[model samples]
Target: MSAATLAAADSATMLRRYLLRMRRYPSLTVLLVGMPVLLLLLFVHVFGGTLGAGLPGGALPGADGRGRYLDFVTPALVVAAAIGAAQGTAISVAMDRTTGIVARFRTMAISPVSVLAGHVLGSVVQSVLAMGVLLVAAVALGYRPGAGFAGWVALAGFLVLLSLALTWLCLALGLLSDSVETASNLPMPLLLLPFLGSGFVPVESMPAGLRWFAAHQPATPVIETVRGLLDGRADAGTAATAVAWCAVLALAGWAWSLRLFRRTTTG
Candidate 1:
């Protein structure tokens, strides 16, 4: 087989390996799905009514405060679910490193790219699965989205791009960490980005300094784009900005990860 074909075969095998690992050890998947569901329930049931009443325009017409809040917050929760999956990717990568598995692979005839590719593909699948479950939970809680078929398509594309970007970044973080604990903790800040931005509340409602920061941050545009797409009123500018951010992050993470992986494996 050609080098490309060999690499593809190797990557497929590695992907299967990662997926089986996930199935055999289901705690990570459970945590990834459960945390977002719990947060969704807590926000919509406990705090939704009060918070929804405070939205700039108040609740939607014919909708109660809790329902309104559920609609508003579901996109952010989906983003949070993606972030949680990325955290799992980092931990998985770190485990491979510390367990001497990666070192063992280096001595074999496998394609070097296959290892990282497996993690990226596996994590993206996990992220999408978690987001799907979260969305179902949101719908069950009376979160009604205004998205039509096209809007749903756009939303899925954007989510896949976001997950791909985040997965690569976490892959780099995993390769960078000296220990699994550190890898697990390094991505924690990403989980907070949605909350700190326009995830839980409107950016305009924040203090001046915080509001400016929130509006300018990457997460805000991302969340806003998701919100807009779901409402079938996506802004061209916000979508462009979000796509640009994803492109930059994906490229940076891919370069950083490849460099680190080569250095660690070959040196």
Candidate 2:
């Protein structure tokens, strides 16, 4: 087989291995997927009304108070789900390192790239599944949008890009950790990013310093683009910015993760 073919086969095998691990430990799966769902319920039912009523001018232009809030909140929950899965990715990678899985794989005929690719792919798959759960919960909680077929497609495309970038970054962080505990803690701040951005409320609602930071951060454009798409008010400028952020993140994460994987295996 050619080099590319061999790598492909090995990656598939490793992907299956990670998937099996997920299946064997259903509790971890539930916890990872359920946390965001619970957050969605709490935010929409408990806090949506007050928060929506407090929006700068009023509720979203065409939406009722709680209804408009849910539209804004659902996309953020998707982002939170992706960030939360980063913790899982870190733990799984760190565990494999500590338990000598890395060494074992090195001693085998597996392609080195396959090792990292497998974990990245598995985590992305898990992130997508978790997003599905959150979206379903959002719908059940009365979340509705005006997006048509193209808008829905765009939403899913952006989400997959976001998940892939975040998962790769987590994988790199996991490879850098000496222990699973440290790995678990390293990615915690990613979970809080949505709150700091234009997730739950408008960036303008924030204080001056925070507003500046929130408006400039990576999550804001993505969240705003998602909100706009769903509201049938998608702006080309914001969409371009969101795509640029994802591209930069994905490239940076991939480079860093590849280097870390090489260092971890060879050093």
Candidate 3:
């Protein structure tokens, strides 16, 4: 077989390995999916009424505050779910590195790209599954979106891109960590980006400085794009900005991970 075929086969094998790991040790997957669902319930049931009232247009006609807030916050929670999964990816990568599995792989004829690509693909799948659960929870909790089939397709595409970007970055963080605990901690800051951005509330509601920061931050555009796509009113400019941010992040993380992987494994 050719080198490319070997790499593809190796990557698939690695992906299956991680997937089986996820099936066997399901607690982490539960936590990753559960956290966002819990948050969705809390925000929509507990805080939705008051928060919905504060939205620019107020509650939708004939709908209660909780319902209105559900529609608005679901997108943000979806993004949060994706962000939360990155921590899991980082920890898994770090575990493989520290457990000597990665070192063993280094001695074999396995393709180097296959190792990292496997982690990336596995994490992306995990993240997408988590997002699906979150969305289902949102719909059950009175969250109604205006998006049609095309809008759903666009939303899925954007999410996959965003997931790829985040997964790559977390993979790099995992490689850079000296310990699994450190790897777990490094991705924690990413979870805060949504809260700091236009996730929970509109940027206009924030203070002047924070509003400026929130508008400019990468997460805000991403959140907005998701929100807009769900509402079927996505701005071309915002979508472009979100795509650009994802591209830059993915490239940076891919380069960083490859560099770190090469140095650590070969040196």
> TM-scores of all models?
0.97, 0.95, 0.97
**Model 1 lDDT tens row, 1-267:** 999999999999999999999899999899998999999989988898889888888664323888888888999999999999999999999999999999999999999999999999999999999999999998887777888999999999999999999999999999999999999999999988998899999998999999988998899999999999988999999999999999898999999999999998987
Q: Which ten residues in a row have the lowest lDDT in candidate 3?
A: 57-66
List CA RMSD, all candidates: 1.7, 2.1, 1.6
Give each model's clash number: 0, 0, 0
> lDDT by residue for model 2 over 1-267, one digit each (tens)?
999999999999999999999999878788999999999878877888778778766764333677767877998888889888867998899999999999999999878999988888898889989988888888887877789999989888988898888888898889989999999999988887899999998898889999999989998898888788777789999999989998898899899999998888888
Kindly state the number of residue pairs that clash in model 3.
Answer: 0
| lDDT values, one for every candidate | 0.92, 0.87, 0.92
Error of 1 at 131 (Å): 0.3
Deviating ranges (above 4 Å) for candidate 1: 59-63
What is candidate 3's lDDT per residue for 117-229, written digit by digit as tens?
Answer: 99999999999999999998888876778899999999999999999999999999999999999998999889988989999998999999999999999999999999999
Q: How much does candidate 3 score in TM-score?
A: 0.97
